[model samples]
Target chain A: MKRMSMTMVIVLLLIPMALFARGVSEDVTTLTIAGRDGAYGDAMELAIQSYTAKNPNVRFELLKLSGSELMEQSVIELRGGTGAFDVILIDDPFLTQLQEAGWLADLDALYRKKGVAIDPDLVENMVNIGRYPYPNGPLYALPHVGNVALFAYRQDVSRKYGIEKFDTWSQVLDVAKKIKANEPGMAPILFRGVQGNPIVTGFLPIYWAFGADILKDGKPAFDTPEALNALEYFLELAKYAPQGVTAYQATQVSDALLSGVGAIAIEVWPGWIGNLENPELSNVVGKVKIAAHPGEVKRSSSMIGAWMVAIPKDSKNIDAAFDFLLHLTSAETQAMISEKNGVPPTRHSVHKISSLVAMYPWYPAQLDGQISGSIRPRTNYWAEIESVFGDYLQRALVGNLTAKAALEQIQRRVTEIIER
Target chain B: MRNRERAVYSSFFYIVFAPALLIILLLTTYPMVTILYDSFFRYSFVVNTRTFVGLGNYIHIVGEELFQRSLINTLVFTLVASFSEVVLGVALAFLLKRQFLGKRVASLIVIFPMIISTMVICAVWQIFYHYEIGLFNHVLTTLGMQRVGWLTDQRVALASIILVDLWQWTPFAFLIIQAGMGSIPSEIFEAAQIDGARSGQIAVKVTLPILRNQILLVLMLRTLDTFRLFDKVYALTGGGPANATQTLSFFIYREGFKFFNFGRASAASVITLVGVAFLALFYVRRLLGEEE
Candidate 1:
């Protein structure tokens, strides 16, 4: 009798364990995505909801992290081949490193398996960034956030200064000087002068416009005269910036522009100015003009800062992730996200959508920038390179180092990083 | 029987302590060994490449200007912030040792900053240090004084961060000193009073001597904590306005996590660990001497 009762209890425990196991293994396919937080997070959440609503068997576990945190976690996981994340969001510049390392899945093979091709609606330049080699390589990722660095100016202030157009960096500097002299209370120029990515990113458009290549023929090119001129002009423009411009981030720049306290912003990402047109939030709603960066020695060179989505090579559910990625980047979904979350769309059709264009008046400018945007050099050492470059650049900006000295230091350090 | 009992006791002790020892070895010693190993190689985490280049990473990092600057900045921050915190803490503890009304409330207020999250504290201070719209600049302007670039000026940026550290961590030192003071016999104060010792004399000659160990303990703790300054620098200045606030921890983070140059980062970490261990040894030796 005792043995029978013990066996009964064991059987009862086993029943629930079996049921629980079955519950987990049942047709539920949970796709885990490591994505960015903030607006991108919101957009991902929307896409996940829509995706799950259509496919009842599919669930999602989304890890929304900051840019740095995402990079750190993804690198650790991908390098270990842990397959912890099925999909990841990578900043465009970091995409090169990941692709070169063979950490990302071959999307070309997946597309071939699915009997589909990359949609033509996605901007070629934006999509090309997902490739490893410059413009033609095996696709490893897709552009999710069509981010391009653009310049912003107070149109009213520009007109008041009798500036019909800002065609050159020198012209912009002249206008800034005029604005600074006339409007003592207002900051005539603004940029993210904070060290590292912020300062480097803010300086790139100007750097490229001055015909300076960050990497010329696969080597550090900061020692060139073009880079020196760019830095000199940037310092001149800095004279008209706020006293604490070196501490400024995206928030400060956007706040300065929206408060109508700044005449021009040297760099403005689409993500930062999503609320620029919101009348309640902006004092300069109708006054600001967003456009591609003006030229100096070269034609306009807007820096591409798109965020890309990729399936990790070790992903357990490649087909599911690829399906979700396609859905997420589709024109319909992009339009929805663009309309609701103000996430800049990767698709040209979404950018041209009447509603989105009306909402984001700079949609045309954004599309143009995306088509013509220049991506940072596809080098594995970009993170280190950008850091060294930004450090010296900021030192020069704060009068710690002269422009020539800063470029020389940057060139030396970058050369060291490359050689290592 | 005693031997048998001792054997059983030893077995019990081993049973209880072995797992913990193993965990500690795995957690601390394993990482240290790995870092030491990695420091000798040219490893790039992003590229998944590791090439053995004995001492090359160390030599390269030591030669780098930024690494040297970061080391100096970290040492300066550690000394200034830690010393300021401990001294201010002792002063506050001395002030609070007396029986006074609202002592509990005052103590709570004193420890408030210490209890708040570091990121939150940094956020609050970021606003306070803003040049145009900050509370400090507002007060300065109201007083018809020139506005200071609390964070934007390289000369003042690190000091500005140190001030924030003082604000947040002085309370911790105060708490330690206060606890030490509380443990001291009230009769000692009474006896000192009877011997005609004034308040300042008693504090300087008696109380301070008695509180030397606690002060040293606080100093060691604060020194170690301030030596790894990353968050405030990250949130406030991003080690900027010309890398004035770039601490060793920030440097390691940039190299290891941001750039994925594991070899260089490991070398930097080993160097930092050695510095911290030396500092700890000096304090521990002094503490042990005091105990003896």
Candidate 2:
């Protein structure tokens, strides 16, 4: 019994010392990153490899999570103050919510401590998206994925029909009808029609093109005539989509485009069509053209959907994570990642690289979209709004609700969400 | 001397049972109590804000159209999927119970769907259910029939999901029912045959009566399992084509995880728990009554 007591005392004494050692090492050693999957994951892996090669002392624990998974985990961990993730990726819409909750480390303070300035090479507009108050608030994140909604169509098919320019929604619709008439085998229109994020994202560019806004002066704007027009036009355009359009996601849309079975997609992201020119991966090599969406009542409305990287406020290795963040967003690193992984870079110099432009052929249009594209409404309630809107929009598409009725329902629901 | 023995026995019982009893309380009772408490508040988990709303959340959620629709859809899914799966399972159990060629292989094939991953099943079914180029559509077109939207049309999407559920879970029911059937004596059937009872009549009067407890057991298990349907709906339809396939679990997921409305999610969860508790009580009472 005396020996056991002695042993227990020693174990109890060592526990605090071990905890002290961990506390000391936690701020300087391993950096845990809660990142994204797919191409973004690849890009982050490349950056981690390069960073680790330079600083052999720093280790990484990377979690490549789905978009929703990332958001949910980040919230749970950050809320609990677990310090589980040193760095996290935030979808732009959710960034506002995270920032509002003060869950992100102040990047500006980190920069001041490091005695460095924010790089001008990074797109200013994309950088501003990481701001809490949006475009003016202190920086909390850096743009990691320069995603913008882009329109894609078969150039060959358009030339064959003598439709040289897509200047308006009407022109696109006319072309879709002609293509459907001429080529029964080809689907004239394609977009992500599944409910929630996919459907909302696919419809936003068209919604903006028709001069409709999701929010105006902190109020819901779905009841406007322009919004009704946009929905009516979208429903009409959706008629030319595939029979299973309502089930179409990014994979189906991209597959349809790449296999040459789809003539036009009203909304396509830069990441989805990375292999559009790859002969081995695409059947429509050199046949498809990617550009900004066609204008309707307004100029082409490219929806910016950049993913941002930030150091969590509860992160232990904040300094190391900030350094890695800088390296990940650097021009050379962005260029290398873009080349290898087909991830769109947020840096202006990387976007302007001639080789990348040659391979992508839409870099200029993508850069233009990044510079001027309208972002989703900057509100903490965007997710709820998007969910409600997507649900109603799909109800309209499936003929359960008329366009006007859907908009009215969205208006009512969005008001409720915002008020609450 | 008797009192001393009883004291020792009682002390031993407490010593053995304390840890397990404490663990059970920590695991189940704590979270349930927390959920019940939170359901009466307005809580934003992310911002760490809580306001006592005093049944406002419950009232609001119960009145929402989406919640009503989700409740109805979940009930339909549970009832249809559970009953159909039980029926199909019994039919299959009867078919396979008789001595036949390749019995082992047939049994293996019968249980294949239950063993495979739900996501993989959903993926294969998704391709088959694809509206344009799906195998089902291709077959329909080849036979000069109009292509049906198996997953897109609201009217058909729920039915299609139910069909997939039946395909996956009927095997489980089959295994349980078959085991019960296997326990029945060969002499019972022989006596029935000798008494000039027809095959159909024997199955209905004697066999089914004997399998009543087993059938009820299978039905209860299936009902409970089907009531929590999530992953298939998440992978295949994402509670979509206009929320036609949304279950109570999916509703809570969207409210809790997606929207971070913890209070509302708690209310929905409490509602579901109450429902499941009622169902479990009904089944347990029946089973226990049978035993009695």
Candidate 3:
């Protein structure tokens, strides 16, 4: 009787194993993507739907998350070598740290294995952002989102102040003063003043324009004269900003610009002003002009904030993820996503699409910025550096510290961080 | 025979207690030991590297200005918010101790804030505290007063967060205290009344002493919860307006996750654990001494 019972248990287990083996032999592959939320999530869903329609044997699982949540989850999962995610989207500034840890699979190797070449239609500068050691190293990812920081102003407001163009930071300040004096209840200058990433991103273009750099030959440069000048200039211009501007974030700045209450925003993202031309959603349709940031001691340059997509080293479906990446970045897909979801495209061909250009009049300027924009200091310690820089910069903004004092304090803290 | 009976009892006790003991060790003791070990090294989670630093991390963080500021803010937030909530909770419990009209509805209304999600509460309060168009600012403007930066000004930001926390958590304290008040035998109050005691005397002499254990328990829970304040500050301030609302938990989060400096984060965690353990011991000792 005991022998019969053991045989029954074995038969039951064998039945399921045989069934599982049969299931595994089927021609279906499910690729998991750790993507971003909001418009990016919508765009991913559209691409998944299109891909599934063409290739019925493949399916997808998309984990749509916020930027921070995505970073935290991907780090934890990738660190464990779980093979839970096939594809992951990374912020450009953070890609280096992940690459340094060898978390991402090599796209160059995958391309060579498949006997194919990289698509040249994607903006070369954006594509270079995914390369470790920056611009001359092996490619590990592809650009998924083309984000460039741009300057925006109310053309009518500037013309009313008798200024045709902002050629420098000083010119911006003069225009801001005139707007504040003449236009009651209108904020003349706006930027994200909340501390950390928002404040640092908003301040970098100005910092760079003043011939100051975060790192000069791999050391802190905040103690330089140019950094102090840029900070003092920033504080003076901030006088014409809205009350409670220290609390302003992307939402507040974008709201002020869209409602016509802001005359000039020192920094704006393409994603934030996608609906600026829509009459129903925007109060200043056809009245706003977005362009490259103005210069100071040096020439103007925009900041590149592209999101990169890569396959994790532990992903079980690297080939599938790589194929999907190609589909996701193709010019046709980029144009479709731009029209339907308002995600800026990373391809030259997509930028020249007449329909897209008409909808987004800043496409030419965005392309120019993409070609010549500056990437944030690429380092494994970028997060720590940005955090320290932001904290002291806001201390100056709120009058807790003078510009020179803030720069000196930043120099001390950042030098310690790098040394540690 | 007595020895045999004791052995049987021991066997049953072991059988019943083993699973819970194993679970407790796995869940609590293991992580505590890991954090303690990691605190002694300069650890990087990303690079998977660790260098022995002895007490360097602890000394460095203790001397850091940001850590000092975060500690002060956390202590101020805890003392003010928890005491205010407990006081308000006791007051509301006494005022409603007697039978009143619409008692069920009143109790429900009093507990509404605690029942709602914290993120939802934060969203509502964020709108109410907006600088330009918020309800509070609009009312102030209507009364011919200048608009206040409720969240933008460093002086007012921490106070505003404390107010929100008190609003959301006072009901929790009220529920526990009211339950304690309910469990007291009515004859004690009657005896006090027959002894010529007034309402105030009875409340102080009879009711409060009887409810001491419950109050201490609630206070301990609130202290521990408020000490680990993270979500509200994260959703509302992001520790901003120049680090006005940075708490120890926020500091540790930024160090561990944002900067990936596990050694400093683990050190901060160990320090927080010791502080919380000390507070728990004080409350537990008081409760035990009262019981004896």
Candidate 4:
């Protein structure tokens, strides 16, 4: 009886083994993509739904994750030479790291192997973000999302505040102060205050507007007077900001803007502000104007935060992966995401589409922003430097440190990181 | 003939232990060795090149003021949080030892936090800690007091996280002590009461003496666990408001995962390993003394 039972257990295990073998890929099968969450994920899902209809055999396993989680997992699997993921998505901030590490398969080489040049409708500036020593370098990925930091304000309110021309940070700050005093029970300004990328990205345009470079001659120069003045200006503007602004993330800031509780959003991303014009989403429709940031000591400086798609270096199904990637970033798909879901397009031509422009008023401004926006410093120490700077900057904003002292302390630590 | 028997016994034990021992060596010892070896180099995930630096990473981490502050913050949090947990846990366990109106239900409620995941706990606590919308600030506001920046203020952020840790883990220490107390014969306590000893006298003399080993065990375990505080800081604050809550694990994670500066991360890990090892040694000594 015991021998019979043991035999039955062994057979049960073998049955499952047979079922597992049933998971074997067909000669033409599905492509698995590890992409990002939020609107980007929605955009990918929408594109996949449409693409799968035409090519019914091609199924998809789309893993939508946060930016940080996606990067960590991709690196771990790629480094371990696990070919589980066919195609992977990366934030542009990490492109420099991933591409430089040789973790991503070179797309140019892949294109040559497939005997094709590349997808053409993709905007050159957005496409260039996928390259190492970006803008004129080896292509390792394809831009999936063309995101830029833009300024948004209540257009009618700005007019009432006599802020007819928003050309400089000083003008925006002055208008914000008046709006604070005159506009009762409403936040005059709003921005992300979460540390790391949110706060740093929000502050960058203003910093650049003050002619303060995050890096100078390939080294940290945050201790300079320009950076100090920029931080002081940031603090001055924060005086008129919403209470509890220090804890604001993208969601809070957007909720405030969309609910008509705030006047100016110092920094707005296309993905978060996508439904601005939809009455279903926004309490105040067509009131907020999304455009390039008001420039100060420098010309309008927008920060580019594009999402790029690439095959891992260890991908077993490279051909299948590249197929999905091409389909994923195609003009039709880009236009569809833009029109249907407001997933911002990386391609200029897609943005220029009449139907798309009708849906998103910021498309023209977005295109201009993408073409001219500045990418964050690509140093391996960018994460560390940003954290240190963001922390001290928040301290200054919260009145824990004077702007000068904050800059001086950050300058010392930032230099040390750069030197390392 | 005696040596032959001893040799045979040793071989038999080794044969029994070999597979399990090898698993430990592979899983635990291998990672330790790797981190230790990597600490001597400048490791970059971006470059994928490792250059020998001979303590350069350690020197660099030490020179960074944030690292120093994180070390102090982690140490203070570990000592304060763990000590309070053991004391409070013992007290609660002792209080609940008797038959009460809803003893079973009360016990379940107390151990509820231990079953829940730390991430879930952090999520709940984050809502509670929010300055404007959180229940904590709301309570303060209702009482006609100024709202507090529970997670934003550098002075209070780490302590607020500590409160969350204590809440989630005091139950663990309580359960262990309760079990230890249950195993002790009730006759000892009955005899103490027969001698007309006061409740306080019996607790100080009998209950504490018996629970001493269990308390020590809880202390060691809690200390080791609390030292590796990463998730709370990650989910709640991300070690913000000026490195106030930056623990050693977070420091390593930032360097290793975020920056891919594995060498520096390895250095930080080695420093942590040494600290934990010292703690382990202290516990072992206490354990030995108690056993004797």
In order, what DockQ does each candidate have?
0.86, 0.75, 0.74, 0.49
* Candidate 1 per-residue C-alpha lDDT over A212-294 given as tens digits, one digit per residue, 9 for 90 to 100: 88987898899998999989989988998999989999999999999999889999999889888899999988889998899
Error of 3 at B74 (Å): 0.7
Q: What number of clashing residue pairs does each candidate have, in the order they appear?
A: 0, 0, 0, 0
> What level of docking quality does candidate 2 show?
medium
Share of native interface contacts present in candidate 3: 0.70
Model 4 residue A350 lDDT score: 94
Per-residue error (Å), model 2, residue A409: 0.4
Q: Cα deviation of A26 in candidate 3 (Å)?
A: 2.6
- For residue B244, model 1's alpha carbon misses the true position, in angstroms, by 0.5
- Stretches of candidate 2 above 4 Å error? A1-28, B1-15
Q: Which model is ahead, 1 or 2, in terms of lDDT?
A: 2
lDDT of 2 by residue, A1-420 (tens): 999999999999999999998887765589899999988998999999999899887989999999889999999999989999999999999998988889999999999999999998899999999988888999999999999999999989998878766889899899999999999799999999998888999999889999998999999999999999999999999999998899999999999999999999989998999999999999999989899999999999789999999999888789889999999999989999889988999989998899999988999999999999999998888889999999999999999999999999999999999987
lDDT of each: 0.92, 0.93, 0.92, 0.86
Please give each candidate's TM-score: 0.96, 0.95, 0.96, 0.93
lDDT of 3 by residue, B1-292 (tens): 9999999999999999999999999999999999999999999999899999999999999999889989999999989988899889989899879898999899999999999999999999988889988899999999999998888888899999999999999999999999999999999999999999999999999998899998898888899999999989998888978898999999999999899899999999999999889988998999899999
Instruction: Estimate candidate 2's alpha-carbon lDDT, on a 0 to 1 scale.
Output: 0.93
lDDT of 4 by residue, A1-420 (tens): 999999999999999888777765453576778888878889989988998888787788999988878878888877777787888888887777777667788888888988988767677878888878777888988988888889999998999977765999989988988887899978999998876777899999999988998888787888878888888899899888866777788888898999999899999999888788889989879898989999888999788988888998788778777877888788888888888788788886898989778778888889888888898888667788888888888878777789999888888888877776
Chain A of model 3, TM-score against the native? 0.94
Error of 1 at A39 (Å): 0.7
lDDT: worst 10-residue window of model 2 chain A:
A21-30
